[model samples]
Target: MAPVNEAARPALKAGTRDAHERRIDRAVALIERAIAQGEEPPELGRLAEAAAFSPFHFHRVYRAMTGETTGQTVARLRLLQGLRLLASERRSVTDAALAVGYQTPQAFTRALRQSLGTAPSELRAEPERLWREIDRLAQPPQPEQGEDAPPLRVEVVSIDPFQVVALRVEGGYEAKHAGYERLFGWAGAHGLLDRLQGLYGVAVDDRRDVAEPQCRFDCMLALGEGVDPTGLPGLRLTRLGGGRYARIRHVGAFDGLEAATDALLARWLPASGERLGDALLYHDYLDDPDQVPQALLRTDVYLPLQC
Candidate 1:
């Protein structure tokens, strides 16, 4: 999905409605602003105070809402800032460390190596190699199909047609989080969060056939009845036609979807005598990543099948 335009966001009303989302937004904004300003990491108590939450309950609330603890957020932002200073500003390791709130170059190098699998000096010396490593790390582990491993099970089922509000994005699938975040914020503002029925990811291009930078993805939220998106500017409504689909349950990180899909197409289809249908393949996300552990994230990959 494309990065959301800040101006396109709906104006939120002041009330008790969506109070949790508002607080989360405020906390996230505070953390981001502090990071961008090169200030020391905000204390947990300070962040909680800014979000109008008690420090005692703030950590659990932040983790439930954002999928990471407050300390993790701080560390991640600082690490990203350090990387930017090293890559874009061409700063030395020592300078980048201090600039990003690390006490010493050694500490910065240790964190960098832990996060990116490369030392700061190595990143400066061989940027391309670092990218290759990062890409390797991004790939999901391929499932082992040995005799001891269970076979990949696929169930063919008929699904009814559905209406969705989709945000089209052109780029790597890893970037879809921004689109989903925007959708969540919009839904919260409109008091439509409870009305959401499902979340779907439509893959417009096969990553194996298209370059990562040119791939297309759509982040879709399935709208329940009576939740009309009509007259809503910047909202694109799409109807997914009803059809027979081969569904494969994928259990793990989002990165594993591609590999699971590959397994379905390469191993299952030819053996099952199933022919492909005209409609695009998509994923039905069953668990919210923000609230679930990565190892337990569940998604159902649906491939349109010939009737």
Candidate 2:
């Protein structure tokens, strides 16, 4: 199945509803502005006024159109910027916490742990540890597979909760691949594995599903809390956008990922429109393939479709 073209959606009259589009545009712009300043966002009521939406209807419509509560989206944006600072800065954890707008270090730590699953200190100690792991995997061995392998037994479902570290990129196909490899190497060299839940390839652009002319992708790593970005070089962290997705748990290899993706978008999507909502086509690995291949592999491929 051909990938859905997000640009094409703009041409569809039903997708261009005046009220919904304004809400989404306002919400997105608000976030972009907040991230740039590295701070907490303003009240939803004020945002609603700016978007020309009544406060009572703004929250519901915003969530309906964007597939996220306004608070969740804003909180995530602030935290991603905060995590980057924490990982790359040399300042004390308390300083990093305050830099991102937390009233206190303890409050920041509590939020960090809930979101990323690690305390602040362990994340700070990953530099040396990551480097060692990268050195170990410098030369990866080939995998051997049986010719008659059964269709990799897998279950396709919907996933709405997951987080990832994503860097937006614009470039050639080869450059994208190389970028991800470098990111993987960086993650390993920094002992990021200990702090990360897993590694992921997150698509942040509307053009990704399109062909060569427009496709773009975000190379990402999924880390728990405490993975500071204070001292890391040339990296930015962005959370995976949360939403409804058609999910699949595939085993064996990542090579045939497209085929599974097709099944959801082409085969299942049309039938499941009633339960679907506005969301992106999302994909996330259940575990790291580097650590174990043919080792009970699990991956969730999320394709946002109308419910």
For candidate 2, write residues 62-88 as lDDT tens digits. Answer: 544444556666656555555566667
Task: Tell me each candidate's TM-score.
Answer: 0.49, 0.39
- Expressed as tens digits, the lDDT of each residue in 1-307 for candidate 1 is 2111112113244443356547766886787787777677677788888877666445534554454556667777777767767775457889888886888999999998787777888787887765554454333233333224457777777777787888877777456887787777778888889888889988775554467888778898986655555444456878664777778889999877766775665455544555556676788899989899999999988877666
Indicate which candidate wins on lDDT.
1
**For all candidates, what are the clash counts?**
2, 30
